[model samples]
Target: MAKRDWNRRTCAKRGHTTYAPSEPELRERLHVATAAGEAWRCLRCGDFALGAPHGGGPAAEAPPVLRGKALRDLFVLRLLAVERGLRGVLGVLAAWAVWKFSNSQDALHQLFDQDLTVFKPVADHFHWDLEHASVVDTIRKTFDYKHSTLVYVAGGVLAYSLIEAVEGVGLWLGRRWAEYLAVVATAAFLPLEGYELHEHASAVKIATTVVNVLAVLWILLSKRLFGLRGGVEAFEAERHSASLLEVEQAARAVPAADQAAV
Candidate 1:
């Protein structure tokens, strides 16, 4: 029989008081222990404890809060959201520019009369439309000597497209710099989009404008984008749960090894 002193030492290490069980009580406890048992070792504290028969208190320390990776991932998501919103703004701008230019007889005429044969199918394709004829005629009469306007619009589009390209690539690389750049660029165009909707008042225009506005709000407020969701402690708790599962699996494997030994 194990000495009462040894039992007391074991119980003390486990943060419990020891009491000798009667024969019947010992059998009952042993049966319960075998059903729901856990074995643990605490080195510095010199403790070796087994789980209670049915359940137990906390087994490990609480995990630390999320810090580094949490912040970085939030930044990445924020940038990605900003990039999306910016691209949406750019799209609206491109569409508006096309709409305004088409309405201008001078612009349409200039574009229509250009050597579109160079672009093959594109020039010939839209030319067949009756509206295209009106556009061509309008441009010829309105902008007779202002070919410079066409040059300006083309240059502006090229520059804008280049900016979009840079933002998109940076976002793909998960850079926070790209996110800030995207917010600045897209915000700059909000007034333009608003003015366009006010002037045109079409369903299509209104929908496009609303979409960009909401996109901006979503990026700014989403927990994942803002880095306001789970903290470091949450991440550590998950890791700890995984560790417990691994330990339980290892314990089960032990009996299999003993059987193989026999």
Candidate 2:
């Protein structure tokens, strides 16, 4: 099996971002004459692309194109963003359901009673109790809650949903603040998730708890949040070093004629 080339895959998908550096050494190293035409090395995937450069500037002004682990991290963050967005959507639906139920409690309860009778025959066939089943009993108990309490519950769910949506948008855009928010928010919920898992050891509960735990750790440690792993300064230094390495590697492959021109 071939290892994935995230840099090249991203370049291929998004198109290469060729750059002409104003620095004498970098300019010479990246500029090349090919059979097709004059070409410049892409700052992103390090591939030589034929054409006029997309942009030209000092080395420091070159666009910060993601590559290697940075590109991989972007993928991970986007995936997490999608997950968060989905959870937010589900939460909103749950809140709406709760709110609607609170408003039509009596009618819904009557309808549920009818539905119970409809399902009673099937339950008898399976030797199960229709109304006494844990899930059914839980639903029945919700009907006993006060309207104000249900409204409060719905508001809480809506608030949580909005928070998740905000996290999704920020994470999708790769904001540092969003990473911090996600780490903090998810960490804060771990105890609740753990409590739920302890109360009901279902596969869904266990999986949710595990994913949240991993996500919190992954973001906090990988992102160096709250001064972990040498803090944000070291985190930034690593990325800067990676960028410099890309330039150096591209410079290393300069043709003799190009090298001589410098």
For residues 147-202, what per-residue lDDT tens digits would candidate 2 score against the true structure?
99999999999999999999999999989999998998898899988888788789
Give the runs in model 2 whose Cα sits over 4 Å from its true position. 121-128, 244-246, 249-262
CA RMSD of each candidate after superposition: 18.5, 4.1
The regions of model 1 sitting more than 4 angstroms off are 1-138, 141-145, 223-262
Q: Write candidate 1's Cα lDDT for 10-56 as tens digits.
A: 33454532112233422232223333464333221223346532232
